[model samples]
Target: MTIHFSCTQCGKCCHNLRLPLSLDEAADWIRRGGDIELFCEAIPWPVEPPQSDAQAAHKRRLSFAAMCGAVPIRVIVTVVAAFDGACPHLLHDGRCGAYGQRPRVCRIYPAEVNPFIHLTPASKACPPDAWTTDKPVFFANGQTLDSETSELISQSRAVAAQDAQLKERLCAYLDVHHMALANEGFAIHKRAPDVMLAALERLKHDRKQVAHGAAATWRFVSNRLSTVDTLVSIGADTAEVSSLPNALVSYIAFFPSDV
Candidate 1:
């Protein structure tokens, strides 16, 4: 069934709402000279420590939690401006200040035309006669909608794929490191141990799997090694540890000596 919708310019959708944005939407908002900062905040995800006692629990937490949780497929990381009470951009005259060039999200208010999902908020904020909800509807203000829609779908898919790949790599790294530490104890105040060598080898292999080029590999390997270097500099390995490596050594240093 063909359906249409018209926005009543009520500020209900703009106030106390967390609107997710796509890459295109974010770009459009930036072009409109919108205060992007007001739209988004970095929300930290909850994390549980890795199962392995030897694993760097905090280090693996971010990547591990991300992998286990669902990544929003089309929701690109962008500033989502919402007013503390009502949107600051909303004017006392019952209109948006940047109506002509508002964010793509704003332009499509109350009508989610994207095929993957639909969003509908109640009509309480609008005047009693200004809007209707008798039926589910989606409205886009454009001609040649098919072509534009196709292009947008394609671009959103590409972006989703890239984010998936990055999340996969990070998860794999955490998974491998966690496995290496299982059932193994590492000394914090000792030189590299044999087990440490094994852990390093596993970590290096994981890096090589993700990093293709020599330069890329070098950068990745060096960054991983730098953590060890920092630990060693801080006297994490004052004595020789035959089975524990620098990572394990560093992990131990953070615990109380009684432990």
Candidate 2:
């Protein structure tokens, strides 16, 4: 089936947004006085997911591998420009203030970076009329038909892989080691502006120094004690969900069945 989309300038997508950004874009965001939110989740490795190799490859492309105690895992860190109300660059005239220099994610709007996630207009915040426009063809035959959108998506994935390792190290400096299980939800860590910018600066300038070296281990946290016990018994490091009740970090789950 073909999908057609044209933004109605309603700006719903721009409000209460946590737009994903590249490492450099993240630094630029903070420099422009925007906040950085690290949304982290982990996938158990060699405990091996039920997915096919192709599905696994997609996950690997977007995640950095790390160890959670004796259990191996892959970590995905989504560096987001977490803003509320409206994007700082969204103009009152319903235009983008930083249009030319906007992040790739901004340009790839209404399209997903993950190939597995098919674009569904009803699932989006856009008004119904946005998809009723007669001219633009966004997707067709279950694939993105817009060459520019396709290219941007490719670049987004490539940059994600390129930034993976460094992002993992950045997390260490910020003391962000806890993660929600893959597909369960993300443990959101909101960093102080000074601390985050400093880490990103260090990431920009230094590449060799490791954080925690071979000693750093990530732990999973779940709301249900039974899920915590299940992971712990399997040698996956874990922590109580209630242990963190502060401004810096929190967990948001997609489903209550994490237990």
Highest lDDT scorer: 2
Positional deviation of 152 in candidate 1, in angstroms?
A: 7.1
Task: Please write out the lDDT profile of model 1 over residues 1-259, one tens digit for every residue.
Answer: 3333445666766777655444344335444444332110111223444568433332332122221112111111222443357665678876888776555555544444344344333543545444355533343443213344445545544543443323334323322211111112221121222332333344435544654321111000111234334333543322222233334223222222321
Query: Which digits, one per residue and each the tens of the lDDT, describe model 2 over residues 1-259?
Result: 7888887878778788888999999988888778889999998886565567788888887888889988999999999887778889999987888888888988888888888899998878888888874949888888888899999998998888888878887887788888998877789998788899999998878767654573357989887777789888989988877776577899987767444
- Cα displacement (angstroms), candidate 2, residue 178, comes to 1.0
lDDT of each: 0.35, 0.84
Please give each candidate's TM-score: 0.35, 0.90
lDDT of 1 at 62: 16
The residue pairs in collision within model 2 are none
lDDT of residue 113 for candidate 2: 89
| Number of clashes recorded per candidate | 12, 0
